[model samples]
Target: MNNNIKTILITGGAGFIGSNLCEHFLNKGFNVRVLDNFATGHRHNIAPFNNNHNFQLLEGDIRNLKNCHQAVEGVDYVLHQAALGSVPRSINDPITTNDVNVSGFLNMLVASRDAKVKRFVYAASSSTYGDSESLPKVEDVIGKPLSPYAITKYVNELYADIFSKTYGLETIGLRYFNVFGRKQDPTGAYAAVIPKFVIQLMKHESPVINGTGDYSRDFTYIDNVIQMNELAMTTSNQKALNTVYNTAVGDRTNLNELLNYLKEFLAEYDANIGNVEIIHGPNRAGDIPHSLASINKAKILLGYKPTHKIREGLREAVSWYWSNLK
Candidate 1:
């Protein structure tokens, strides 16, 4: 391992973010391995990388200690992005969410520590700011978790901090705020807003906007997420080494605004989608009203700069849906 070309492991490398991470590291001439059970992830996401010489896939579940142990061997860095996402999904079955999000995360931390990985970068969530009515959410000031999923993501940060202090393991947490981009699955019941809306409009079906359509989010693009992971992995500052960073552009887009943007953007692909009127649904349980992230720390500390805002990201996403879904 030439240090920079050292082998790294991405836990959910078959899912949208994980697969993109794998592709990114591979392009940078790194040796990458993926451990995924294909539970919520799809094999097709990694299909394009199957022929790449620097890539390997181990079909295993993270819920099993043995599998997590096997994946960590000789891994220089671990990007732990595997988790059961969705606030409503967690509310519906918190036990399963805890099993994967919390317990499974512990397993990975221990395994990575034993394997002597250089850095452990994991996915944290913006939901951890639940009910904290602060604008431009920061990393330190957080409120009570409003959902089971929020609790799990908050726990990830807590455990990562503890691991750094007691166990001498290096950790960095990226608090993703509504990430969406290419290869993000759109068929799942708990599918995220962007993909769900894109697919719905593509099919001439009305996309449901939850609530009065005023809830806003800092919709981050996958490329920006990749930038955050790469920066976190390479940061040298002592303060930046063991902390969490908000991985988003400092902006927000409301659901109704999102609907109009989607319709306008998608019309360039299919003229029919230009006219689809989205229906409003009742407010979802465990759902937060507004979400926005302040990326100043990530910029000043990690030298992290996000390339895509909501509109630019959505344009790319809409193009992907138009071609892939059709």
Candidate 2:
């Protein structure tokens, strides 16, 4: 990878995945700039990087074209991670979700295109699979969206495709499947299962499992996602550009298995976490029963070999929460 490509713009840089990307690229000596409105992102997530001379923060919203344009200026690459994330949140407020995920995504695309960014790498979602029952989801196969959030993400892919074809902009979409790891927020109504479960167990509270606990997901680690972004940004492969790839480990784990692992890891810090009873709840409206990714496309196209599997990543994440949030 050429270190000469100095500047990188990460949208939603104050958020979990985006903050991680900011740190990774900043450590690599790239001039990293962040555009975030702090709507769902936290100030503390980016506080440590404020002192870094190479880090610049554009406290703005992607919903505004001026903010997107300001963030993309002089940036070689754009990692679009800003969006209203949660299926249920979108269910309650589809309009807001569509505005940010769909409209804001278009704004970023137009800004990056006009700026002549070297590459635009954006976060796509596994929910786009929707009602498709196929196990181990492939990039091409998709069903009708089950929720407004899914529709918005699918629209993002569509816009990216049209932008690439019509405007000659290089873009790559990463359909992230339940990404979890360090800096992931475990609070609020829409928090992801892993982090939310970790927080519950840490507090010795009964972690509620949506559905029968048999439903599974390909819970990807944040590090794997970060690697995918870097590869997508820097890859010289002509075929790899302007296409979507599964950014996840090619594996699946059910809620039952997930809780067991969370207990095993968290019990290291507090043995009582093992006694935390798992509670059952109704299945979430937009959630699929099972989600597993076929990483063959990522491996062949971008040479992506995930460093951490579920257990390893969970252990690391547990340790972080215990040390920092406990």
Candidate 3:
């Protein structure tokens, strides 16, 4: 094991983003501990790290205070990524979403405070932007939440702020845009757009767009998300703490453009994928028409510079899906 000062605790470490964090931190030679209940996370995601001596797993839920305490034991940094995602899922089951996203988040915050960890970094959401018609979303300016999921995420920021001021718990909230890449699950009702489209195209089925495909998003890559987390966890700038920053590519891609990119990339593996048709559907209930992030805060505060643009990220992500799912 490589010598490192920090023992990182990544909650929801079996999920796509959390699992990627585990892989990255483990590779960096930090002692890594994972806390996951396997609710939405897959065992296969963390299966590779089982053999690493520096890796430890605490099968537990953040919803339980005792489990949160146990998970934070001896951990230096808390990358709190555990939460029930999906706006539609939250819409259908607001009660469960509140239980996990809000209550569960509070439990982790309390545990991390008691444990006195160096930092508590968490996954916030761009959905917090809600009905706001801003071109590039800034952290401080947000509109009323449109869904239960957005409410939960916004509440998380409030709780984190209170924790920082009241308990002196160092915290940073990463408001992620449409983050997509390898390890993102394509199966399930609430699967993200990129992976879902990739799977559909690979199967020679027409991928459906949520609206007329004019709605846009700042489609952030997973590596950029990881970079923000690392900087948020390790940065020396005190001004960067206890606040949220947009973790995104500072660029937007409409649904039509996104579909075209997916087809263009996936067709490299299967020629017929390029010819697949796209179907349009009704706009989702909790969705906004556009989302783009202003990553200026992250750039100035944490020195964050995204390594991958939309096409670069899509090409790489498509390659991964082709290699693993094919």
**Best candidate (score: TM-score):** 3
Worst 10 residues of 1 by lDDT: 1-10
Clashing pairs in 2: none
The runs of at least 3 residues in candidate 3 whose Cα sits more than 4 Å from the true structure, single-residue gaps closed, are: 1-4
lDDT of each: 0.92, 0.93, 0.94
What does candidate 2's lDDT look like per residue over 180-291, in tens digits?
A: 9999999998898888999999988999898899999898999999999999998999989999999999999999999999999888888988988989999988888999
If both were scored by lDDT, which would come out higher, candidate 1 or candidate 3? 3
Between prediction 2 and prediction 3, the one with superior TM-score is 3
For model 3, name the residue pairs that clash. Answer: none
Question: Which 10-residue window of candidate 2 scores lowest in summed lDDT?
Answer: 1-10
Ranking by lDDT: 3, 2, 1
lDDT of 2 at 274: 91
Error of 1 at 111 (Å): 0.5
Cα error, residue 50 of model 1, in Å, equals 1.4
- Candidate 3 per-residue lDDT, tens place, 45-71, comes to 999999999999999988899999999
